[model samples]
Target: MARPFRRYSAGARWYDVLSGERWVYRAGRVAGIGLMDLQAGDVVLDLGCGTGLNFPLLRRAVGEAGHIVGVDRSADMLAVARARARREGWSNVTFVEADAAELDVDGLRARIGAATGRATADAVLTTYALSVMRDGAAEAWRRAVALVRPGGILAVVDMQPPTGRWRILAPLARLACALGGADIHARPWRLVARDAAPGSVREAAVRGGHIVAAVGRSPGEVAPTARS
Candidate 1:
């Protein structure tokens, strides 16, 4: 069992600095959000939103008119996220502490609806999060995808072994992931590859392909109707 939620609890305060955001990782979030093509008033769900690392990007993409509902299982992580929001004076973000893999999408939708007056979000994003879910990752992905409105977006960014020449760093990559309580081989981006509209999927790689971001339009933007 992953005990790092507790381990992470102690490190939440310094996650931004110690998480290697500057030297690595940030590019994945950038590419993922860029592919989202988010508009000004969209509501976005940030799953496993550890310390709100994606907040600045999501915030910039959505702007002040939009809302962000971040869900994480760690109270400590959410505490940092909440503090970040307060520091930035961002009134548009909300943090909910719950396991994304086990989240109640209907209730979550209701909560989001109550806040945004919309039953579903315009986009759903997860970064280096699914792989950490272990056995719960698939259910988490399903619930997160279901939380988006039809025609909305699903973006996932995660890590795998470094590719080609970068393979020389494979051991280092595994070390980073293992230390971070992540499954380096997850390749969770496959979820988007398998489910998105054929032409709507966009993919990008960074850090020698150790990190990947995939964005795709959800199935059925509009419900089919009866013909006259």
Candidate 2:
């Protein structure tokens, strides 16, 4: 557990290059965000948002009026994320450094309110970050879900062992997951299926099925004017 944090802190600068974003993991995030069906001016909460890799797509989905709150435990990683936002000239994003498992819900809500004029967001997303949370993923997930408005979107993208002919790449997949301190078997996407509004689930498997993306809506009526 501690080892992963150390890696994130020390290796964040090289993460986008070394984390196989182009060849593998990026597909999952792309698919997941697409399934989220975000709208312009929607506020999105990104849990465990390392280095803000999801910022560009989220920004596109939410547009200039929308706000993105990126939460991560690593200050170093958040620094990288901050740099990315600055480099991209994204004024609508905010970075929060806090452990997901022990997140202060009220504090986060207040923070969101301060930024977006609303205490909750229109969506919450976690991509390839939950398995690394290990046993804390559930608690982190609960807190994340709490930060979204009713009928808001939820997206989870995480890793798993490769299936079908892609099984030949199992060793490489394991190595990547191992190096990142992720439990490839974690299947964190199940959280979406378990908690999302009934019949709202949408799923996709990419990167030889080693990456799984799931999107669903929280229960209740989606506020017509839920956007910031």
Candidate 3:
């Protein structure tokens, strides 16, 4: 199936309003970033970074010395992201148009190296987009992690059906995901958690579990959790 760029194309202009940013999705990014614990001067990679909604929070965390490289397959989305950079005066942000599933990792490294003199990102993040990957979320997650420095942070913020009393909201959640072409069943965050170190991984369920955030480190010092 073709990617869902069409859902975002003409509608890209009103996505913040139409996508339920306030009442639903924003909590995921906020909670996810909190767990990532990003540091200033860090070079962060945002995969499937639709319209750069995460830019402001990321900018605050990275500070003036840091840079953000946002990669998205949708040109319409990137156009809005570029405008956001200009409007917000965020010269530190750069947008690269590419598919997350079939990423050109080395080319990206070279481009980033040329632009910011950093070949690898200090952190890799994806919010609400990995599940849409055609090559598979696990492969996309692996590729994203490979772009990060070994000890760098890896974070994923994606959607799932709400739980408990929030289960009442399941229909609405499913509707929203369906409209956006996301897989409500695709718990892509598990890929990150699977590779994360024992003590370094933290998970959160926000919007009453409609959004799930998993923050962890790339394969490194933290010991792997032993299987039973």
- Candidate closest to the true structure, highest TM-score: 2
Model 2 poorest 10 in a row by lDDT? 219-228
TM-score of each: 0.94, 0.97, 0.93
Q: Extract clashing residue pairs from model 1.
A: none
Clashes of 3: 0
What is candidate 2's lDDT per residue for 36-155, written digit by digit as tens? 989999999999999999999999998999999999999889999999999989999988999999999999999999998997889999998899989999999999999888889989
lDDT by candidate, in order shown: 0.87, 0.91, 0.83
Shift in Å, residue 51, candidate 2: 0.6
Worst 10 residues of 3 by lDDT: 219-228
Between candidates 2 and 3, the one scoring higher on lDDT is: 2
- Top lDDT: which candidate number? 2
Residues 98-213 of candidate 3 have per-residue lDDT tens digits of: 87777888988887787678677888999998866634667767788888876788899999999999999899999998888888888888877788767778899988888999
- Score candidate 2 by TM-score against the native: 0.97
Rank order (by TM-score, best first): 2, 1, 3
* After superposition, candidate 2 runs with Cα above 4 Å error: 223-228
Q: With candidate 3 superimposed using the best TM-score fit, by how many Å does residue 87's alpha carbon deviate from the native?
A: 0.4
Q: How close is candidate 1 to the true structure, as a TM-score?
A: 0.94
